[model samples]
Every structure is written in structure tokens, then in C-alpha cells.
Target: MAKNVNPTRMALSRLKKQLATAVRGHKLLKDKQDELVRRFIELVRKNAALRKEVEEKLTTAFSSFALASATLNESYIEELMTLPSNDMTVEVIEKNIMSVIVPVMNFDYEEDFMAQPFNYGYLNSNIELDDAFDNLATILPLMLELAEVEKTCQLLAEEIEKTRRRVNALEYMTIPELETTIVAIRNKLEENERSNITRLIKVKKMTQ
Candidate 1:
């Protein structure tokens, strides 16, 4: 929208003062846009790195489980058949980072899956392999967390776009409109002053 502010000779000082304020506002908004873009890109790179590590570890965990299953006695494994498979627990708590608090998930394992003779407990050698599996499972929630961070970056980018549009409109349209109006008013005032001076000189000569 074009600004319709009228500035007279007496009001030039006020218009200049307000223009200074508007210029400062434009600079501040520009700075904000630059900072948001910088941070958003940084988060994207971090997300890529984290995903790579999680995938590699997850692949290793899966292969370990396959090896364990093959090494154990298939027929003799009936004793631990009742043990849980998808038996994991997690808790998400909030923690702050640069004024934004994100969720952190904690993993818990269900122990005592099988209780029997001393030699009939879980596969002891494979317990570390299972622990590896659990650790990778823990990374699942963090992946979901990275998903959330990525979403936040997208939203912030959108807001920055809208703000930039408004700033451009003001700098290119509104300020120019005000300046044109002020210049027109000053020219009219000077023309009127010259007309009055000519009239006063002619009247004085006629009286003489």
C-alpha cells in the first residue's frame, strides 16, 4: 500500500525523523532473515550426519542378532521361547538448547525374561549383542526428534519469507511516496512566497 502522509514546510523535520526510524527497522529485519537461514542450514547438515550414524549402527545390530540365532541350538531353545521380543520401554523428557527445549528419550530393558536353572538363563555371550540392539533402538526416538527439529527449521524459514516481503514493500513504496509528497509541498510554499513578494512591491510603487 502507498503511504499518503502529507508533509508541510513545518513538518519536514518530523518526516525525516520517522524515516530514520523506518530505515532502522528495515535493517533489523534483514539481519534477522540472514541469521535464520544460517541456522536452518546448519541443522540440516547435522540431521544428515546423525542419520548416517544411526543407520550404520542399526545395520550392525540386526546382523548380530541374525548371527546369534544361527549359533544357538534351534531345538534346545524351547526353554526361552516365552521371552518377549518387542519388549522395550522409553521415556521422553524435556531439555533446553539455546532457549528451545527439545525432547530426550530414555530407554529401558525388561530383564528376567527367563528364570530357570543357572545354566538355562538368557544367552550370556549374546547379551552384549542384545545390548547393541537396545542401543540402536534408543536411537529411533532421537531420529524422531531430528524430524521435529527439521520441521521447526521449515516453519522459521516461512516466517522469514513473509517478513522479507513486508520490508521490501515499505522500502520500495511507502518511503518513496512520503518523500515525493514532502518535495511537492516545499515547492508550493516557495512559489506562494514569491507571488506575495511581487504583489507587495507593486502596491508600494503605486502609493509612491
Candidate 2:
């Protein structure tokens, strides 16, 4: 369907100016969108590598923690083992992603490592293993957060691309079509005026 446009010489001039502005806007948006998409993809790859590292570390830590329990006196440790001292809070602030406003996540973690319940007098064990688990636990949230932001960035990039395409269409297709229509109408109007003037001149000549 044709865009809702009124064909007029003045209107065509206005549209031509608007098209120029639209083209400039499209270029800026496309550049921003391309940069954001590239950054988002790079982040995603890094997140994947970090995630795998975290998973492997946690798996090993958990297994060792399990073994420590199996070999040691479980009952004594159960009563004395308090939870690890770990605290984290994520704050999200505003930033622009391809002109879309989105959250930039900030992570905060307090530092305090808790020792194990009782030192195994003879069967050697690592208390820091517990600390390792707590550390990784804190990092898990951050990894997940990075993943979320990465996905959101991808979505914003797609939206920016879509908007740019619309702007291009208006600049290159719709407005041009309207301008052509306006020109045709204006020329026809001038031709009719010229023909009327000629007819009036002939009538005066005949009467005289």
C-alpha cells in the first residue's frame, strides 16, 4: 500500500530534506549496531570459556569435599561446620546498547575466608577447599549475569538493525516515490494553466 502522503511541490521539498536526514541517521545507527554486535559476540565467547572453567573447578572441589567427609569423622565436623562467609550483591546501572537503554551489571563481593571445622590431626585435608567452593559460588552468579547481558546485547543489536532498515526504506523508496508523484501533479497543473491562457488569447483575437 502507498504511504499516506499528500502530493505537493512544497511537500516534496520537505520530504527530500527529511530523506537526507534519515540517510544520515541510518548510517550512524548501523555503525553503532555493528560495533555492539561484535562486542557482544566476543563477550559470549569469553563467557563460555569462563563458565567451563568455573564448572570444572566446582566439580573438583565438590568431589574433594565429599571425599574429606567420607574419610574423616563426619559427625564431629557436621556440628562444627558453619556456613562459609560469602556475600555478593549485583547492581545494574544504565548504559546504551545500539541506542537501546539496558543494564550494566556491577558485582560486589565481601572478602572473608572461613576455616574448616576441625583440623584433621592425621588424615590430611584442605580447609581452603571449602573457601574455594565459596569463591566459585560467588563467581557463578557473575558468570550467569554476564551471560544474561550478552543475550540482551544480541537482542538490542537486532532491534537496531531493524530500525535502520526502516529508515533506509523511507529515505530511498517511500519518500522518493512521493516526490515523483508530486512532480507529475505540478507539471500537469502548469500545462493546464498554459492551455487556458492560449484559449483566451484566441477568443480575444477572433472578437476583435
Candidate 3:
């Protein structure tokens, strides 16, 4: 690439301009990559915490539900779970972080007919069933939060990789090639100037 550039003042000027732009672009991309890395790390940490919390809660909720199921008639438990008293809608919205669009989930619940377990009756329901329902409902938002964080982390990580690649291309390849072409042009111009001066001196001596 450097060898193909014409070694002249005009070429030197053009090469210098390209080099400056490349350097500036490299700096900006490098900064972006750094910021993305920072954000990705933070999101990863948050995701880990949320995942752990959600896992623990899910285990507890399921275990409690299982325990309650063991004592209750299978047909009755299935009937109770089949009809949900609450309506839920999940709305997804996009949020920008470091120019990356990540999703934020919001759950909108309709009017609650019954906010507690055994909404039909407490006669046959155990305390474990109540505890299970409470835990499950409480973990809903946490699970959504975990999903958001995880997706954000994934997107940030991808952007970081792309930015790093571009930065490397400018810093290592494009900028260096331009600078080398500039140097070659300047050297060629200087050599021509000396040759002209020497030729003029010889012509003067011959004229004298």
C-alpha cells in the first residue's frame, strides 16, 4: 500500500491528511472499546448476582410447591393451577447504553382477583402452598431483571469486539501505511531537490 502511493509533495499532503484522520478515528474507537468493556463487566457482575438470586428463589419456590402437591389431591392441585386469577403482560422496551440498544422488560398485571394462594379456599391448601405462590410471584421481576442484564452484557461484549477490531485496523495497518508513504514521499522530494541543485551548479560552472 505504501509502495503504491506516488512519492510527491501532493501525495505527501494527502497521506498526512489520511494519517491524521486515521489516528483520530483510532483514538475514538479505542475509547469506545474501553467504555464498552467497562459496561460489559458491570453487567456481567450484575447478571451473576441476579442469576444466583433467581436460582435460589426458584429452588425454594419449586420445592415448596412440590411439598404442597405431595399432600394435596393431584386432580385438585391441577384444577387450582389451571385457572389463574391474575393477568400478566410483559412489555419490552429498548434502552441505549454505549450506543447499544438493550431491552428492558416491564410486567403489567391486571386487576387481582386473588393476591394470595388458595384463592378458592384455605380448607385444603397447606401453608407450604401459600409460601410457594408468594416466592414464585416475588421472583417474577427478578427473573425479568436477570434477563435484561444478561442481554445487555451480551450486546456490549459484541460491540466491544467490533470496536477493538476497527481500532486495531487503524492503529496497526491504515495509520502506519499512511505514515510510511508520507516519509517515502518526503525522502523522494528531498533527493530530487539535491539533484536539481547539483545540476544547476554544474550548468553555472559550464556557462562560466
Q: Tens digits of per-residue lDDT for model 1 on 95-187?
A: 553333455656554453222211334544466445544565566666666766666566666766877797897789767765766677667
- In candidate 1, what residue range of length 10 has the lowest lDDT sum? 112-121
Instruction: Compare the candidates by TM-score and give the number of the best one.
Output: 3
User: Pick by lDDT: which candidate is best?
Assistant: 3
Report the Cα lDDT for candidate 2.
0.63
lDDT of 3: 0.83
Which residue pairs collide, candidate 2? none
Per-residue lDDT tens digits for candidate 3, residues 1-91, read 3656777788888878888888888888888888889878888888999999999999999999899989988898788889777777799
Give candidate 2 regions above 4 Å deviation: 1-7, 72-87, 114-158, 161-176, 179-208
Please estimate how well model 1 matches the true structure, expressed as its whole-model Cα lDDT.
Answer: 0.64
Poorest 10 consecutive residues of model 3 by lDDT? 110-119
TM of each candidate vs. truth: 0.61, 0.61, 0.93
User: Which ranges of candidate 1 are over 4 A from the true structure?
Assistant: 1-7, 58-121, 124-132
Ranking by lDDT: 3, 1, 2
